[model samples]
Target chain A: MRVLLVDDERELISALAERLEMRGIQTRWVTSGRQAIEAMAQDCFDLAVLDVRMPGMGGLELKHRLAQSCPRMKFIFLTAYGSEQAFDSVATDMGDDFYLVKPVDIQELMAKINLLAGKEDA
Target chain B: MNPAPRSLTMDALQFSGTVTAAFSHDFKNTLAIIKENTGLLVDLLAMAEKGRPLDPQRLATLAERIGRQVQRADRMTAELNRFAHSADLPEAQTDLGAMLEMAVVLSARPANLKRVGLEAVTAPPLWIATFPFGLQQLLYRCIALLLDRAGSGGRIVLEADDGRPPVALRVIARTAEDRIPAGETAPTPTPEMTGLAHALQIRLDWDAAAGGWRLTWRDVET
Candidate 1:
């Protein structure tokens, strides 16, 4: 499966992408939303994991843009401040797919990726 | 009763009131997460009782998450302790960059909830002699205000310069709101915020032009 990780924290993003790679997922990581968009233009990604906060351009706006530009790309938001209400607001188009909170368990993350990548249903 | 001293005392009380309220609210959220995690563990145990063996790996991951949350709670308590004690002393030498980083971390959790970015512009560490917690509290309140007024896609910029004495820290509120809040008829500074700058003997300047506010302070003579 092809995946792209966008997080402002470089170390965290690198570590996460490495973990995803170990599970046989091809991953591309970037620190900003703009970079993620650029990567999208260059190649196709089956999934996009976005950190909800960044300096230049943040995640929610990027999500909006991605929906318009690449409708098929699946999204999974990872944030330290994940809350039920916050998820509820974005639950329509991306209904409960995967909203992993920060310090995410690698196993759970892999399981979610499998589901989104259509390798596993649950 | 004469209103002069009463008003001053009332304002002081209000400042303290707000600080405590914010601190308690932060503590509540920390504890709430731990509560939910433990509840999930309890559910896992119940499932095991029904001949459904809980995944050992899942249990281990959950335990680690609980441990991490405990550490987060510890850090919050430590910060609260430092802030509480800061009220006792008049001044100290604190790294301005570190102070801003702390404020960013504390604010980011909530800001991330609304999808607003609370970030510090990466720069050299700036140090200044002042009440560390007071400055942090003041900046935090401003960020919180901006987040409330801003939309989901807004970003706050925080910059600090150590080269200049009374090191200048600039905060730009980029979110759009042409006028101040409705009930607040005047632009008078909050006494608590004003007194903090006054206590440091640093001039605090607030500019409302250009759709944002700028805060600059003069360092004390070494």
Candidate 2:
């Protein structure tokens, strides 16, 4: 599956993309909301993993912007701030399908991705 | 006689909680990076065992990244420790530069989200016996006030006047749109805010020349 990772940390997102690529998933990464928009213009991804808080633009705002342009793209929200409770109150068109906190366990992430891919195929 | 006002207590709790939360958030970011880097190392090792030769440089870079994150986490821990200990005393001999530096660091994440560049331009160690925690809160609020005005590409500078007695501190949170004409009346701070400043014994004023808020005090505390 093709995926895009959006986060401010250069090291974290690049390493995440590399790790996912090793698992046979096509992954692209960007550091900011602006770059994410620029990337979507050039490439398509089946899934997006976004950091909830980032400089300039946050994940929620980016999600809306991305959703407007690419409605079918599935999303997973990651944050270091707090629990999924932080997102529970926000009215999101895309609910936290697989909300994960920081220091995410890769195995669980892989399972969630498989679940998403299966949903897409079905 | 009535007891002292509770604004200090409430304000202290609110500011302390905010700073601690930000520090915890920053630590999470650092830890997340370390976790991802280590996971990468594991992936590389597992692949190498399956006939893929390991790239020494790649492994070294991963190690370096992990080291850098560890250092980042360490600094955050030290800063948080200092911040927590700041409330231990109502008045203490505090270094103004360190105080400004902490304010800059704590305000950085939120300012970045607002796309406002926040910096602390501090000189030598200006020492004063004052309420460290309240001073930090005052500094934080001042910075936040300017960040409110500073839009994208706007810069806010927090600085203490160098080589000046009764060292004045300032937060330049004004955007270009904030400047007023000479004949026009400048905006005044709300009475409630002024009361809080009075409680903190900080002389707060709008410095048109600095295009932000200027704060000076006589090392006084209740």
* Residue-by-residue lDDT tens digits, candidate 2, B8-55: 567678778888888878888899999999999999999999999999
lDDT score, residue A62, model 1? 78
Per-residue CA lDDT of candidate 1, range A43-65, in tens? 88878888765755667677877
Who wins the TM-score comparison?
2
- Residue-wise C-alpha lDDT for candidate 1, range B34-138, written one tens digit per residue: 554555567668768988877989778767766876787798788767657666655777777777776776576557656676668767766567776667666
In model 2, what lDDT does residue B68 have? 97
Where model 1 places Cα greater than 4 Å from the true spot, the runs are: A1-122, B1-13, B105-115, B175-188, B208-211, B219-222
DockQ of 1: 0.03
| Model 2 agreement with the true structure over A3-101: per-residue lDDT tens digits | 999999999999988988998889999999999999999988889999988988988899888888899898998888666676565535556466688
Q: What share of the true interface contacts does candidate 1 keep?
A: 0.00
RMSD of 2: 4.1
How good is the docking of model 2, by CAPRI class?
A: high
lDDT of 1 at B149: 45
- In terms of lDDT, the poorest run of 10 residues in model 1 chain A is A79-88
Native RMSD of candidate 1 (Å): 11.3
